[model samples]
Target: MQRIVLFLLTNLAIMLVLSVTLSILMSVFGIDRQGLGGLLMLAFVFGFGGAFISLLMSKWMAKRSVGAYVIEQPQNNTEKWLLDTVKRYSDKAGIGMPEVALYQSPDMNAFATGANKNNALVAVSTGLLENMSQTEAEAVIGHEISHVANGDMVTLTLVQGVMNTFVIFLARLIAGVIDNATRGNNNQGGGLGGIAYFAVVFVLEMILGVLASIVVAWFSRKREFRADIGALEKLKHSQESQLEGSMMAFGINNKSKFISLFASHPPLDVRIKALRDSQ
Candidate 1:
C-alpha cells in the first residue's frame, strides 16, 4: 500500500512539474499551441519527454525511493556475497556489473532500474537477505540481472511514452471537436465553450489515462515473465525447482490477483505455474 501510494504520488508530481515547466517555457518562447501540428508537438513533448526524463533519473529515483545505498566496498561477508551474486549473474546476462545497493525493507522486494542496460543499479532489501536462502537470493538477483540485460527499463519507457502521446493527443482532439460542435463555430474564448472544452478534456483525460495505465501495466507484467525466464536462462545450474522457487519468492507481495490490468506482476501462482510448465 505504501509503495502504491508512493508510485501514484511520484508520477503525479512528475506530471505536474512537467506541465508547469513546459507551459512556462512554451509561453516564454511564444510557441503557438493552436493547431493539429502544435497539439501533436505538445503531446509528444509532454509524453515522450516525461518518459525520457524519468528514465534518465531512474537510478537516482530508485535509490531514494527505496532508501538504498550502493555498496562501494563489501563491509561484511553478506555484502560480499550480494556483490558476487550480482556480478556473476550480470556476467552471464552479458551486461556490465550494475551497482548493487541494500535498502531497509522488511518486505521481500528488490528491483532493477537505471537509464539503460549497461548503466544500471540493482538493489536488494535487507529483509530479503534476512529471509531468503542462498539459492532463493541467487534467483532473485538473477531476475534483476535479467531485467537489466533485456533493457526492460528502456522498452518500458518507450511503451509509456507512446501511450502517453496517444492519450494526450486523442483527449485534446476529441475535446476540440465536441467544443466546436457545441458552440457552432465560435472563435472566442471563455463562457460555456471554454468550460465545455475543459470539462470534456478533463473527463477524457481521466478515461484515457486509465486506459493508458492498463496498457502500460500489461506491458510491465509481460516483462516480468520475460525477466523470470531470462533469470532462469542466466543461472548456470538453474532447474525447474529453482525457477519455481525463485519466482514464488519474488511474488510474495505480488498484487496482480484482483486488478490484473493495473497490477505490475502476474499473480504468484500463475508465475510459478508458468515457470514449471516452461521447464
Candidate 2:
C-alpha cells in the first residue's frame, strides 16, 4: 500500500511539474496550447517527459517505498537460495543479474523494475519466501526476470507516454473549446477567470486521466501475458506446472471490464488457460 501510494505520488508530481514547465517554455516560444501543433507538442513533452522521468526513478523509489534491502551477502540458506536462483534465471534470460531484495510484507507478491534490461531490481515479499515451495519460488523469480529481459519497464513507459499524450491533448482541446464558448468568442479565448480556466483543465485532466489509466492497464495486462510466455520459454520443460502452482491472482480481474481495467495482472485461471493454450 505504501509502495503503491509512493509510486503514484511520484508520477503525479512529475506530471504536474512537466505540465507547468512545458506551458511556460512553450509560451516563451510563442506556442499557444490552443494551436493544434502547439497543443500536440506540449502534450508530447509532458506525456513522455513525465513517463521517462518516472522510469529513471523507478528503482530508487521502489526500494525506498517497499523498504527493500538488497542481499549483499547471503546470511542463511533462504537468502542464498534466493540469490542463486535469481542469478541462474537472469543468466538464462541473457540479462545482467538484477539486485535481488526482499521487503517485509505479508502478501505473496514480487515485482521487477528498472530503466534498463541489463540493470534491474527484483524484490519479493517476505511472505512469498516464508510460504512458497522451492519450485514455486523459482517460477516466481523466473517470471520477474523475464520482465527485466523483455524490457517491460521501457515498453510500459512508452505506452504510458502515448496514453498521457492523449489525455493531455483531449483535455486541453475540450477545455479550450469550452473556455471560448463561455466567453462568447469564436477564437480560443479564456472567458473563464484564470483560476476557473485552470480548474476546468484540471478537472478534464482528472476525468481523462482515469480513462487513460484504463487503456494503459489494458496494455500492461497484455505485456504481463507476454512476460509469462517469456518465463515459460526460459524455464521450459515443467514451466506450465511451475506457473500453475506459482501464479496467483494479483487483482480482482473477474469483477467487470471497468474493474479489470485496474487489475495488475490477469486472473490466475485465465493465466493458466493461456499457458496451456500456448503449448
Top TM-score hit: 2
The sequence of per-residue lDDT tens digits that candidate 1 reaches over residues 196-216 is: 555566567667877997898
Identify the leading candidate in terms of lDDT.
Answer: 2
Candidate 2, superposed: residue stretches over 4 Å from native? 1-15, 185-190, 226-259
lDDT for position 275 in model 1: 79
- Global Cα lDDT for candidate 1: 0.69
Candidate 1 clashes between residue pairs 3 or more apart in a chain or in different chains: none
Over 4 Å off, model 1: 1-10, 17-34, 185-203, 226-253, 256-259
Q: Which lDDT values do the candidates have, in the order given?
A: 0.69, 0.70
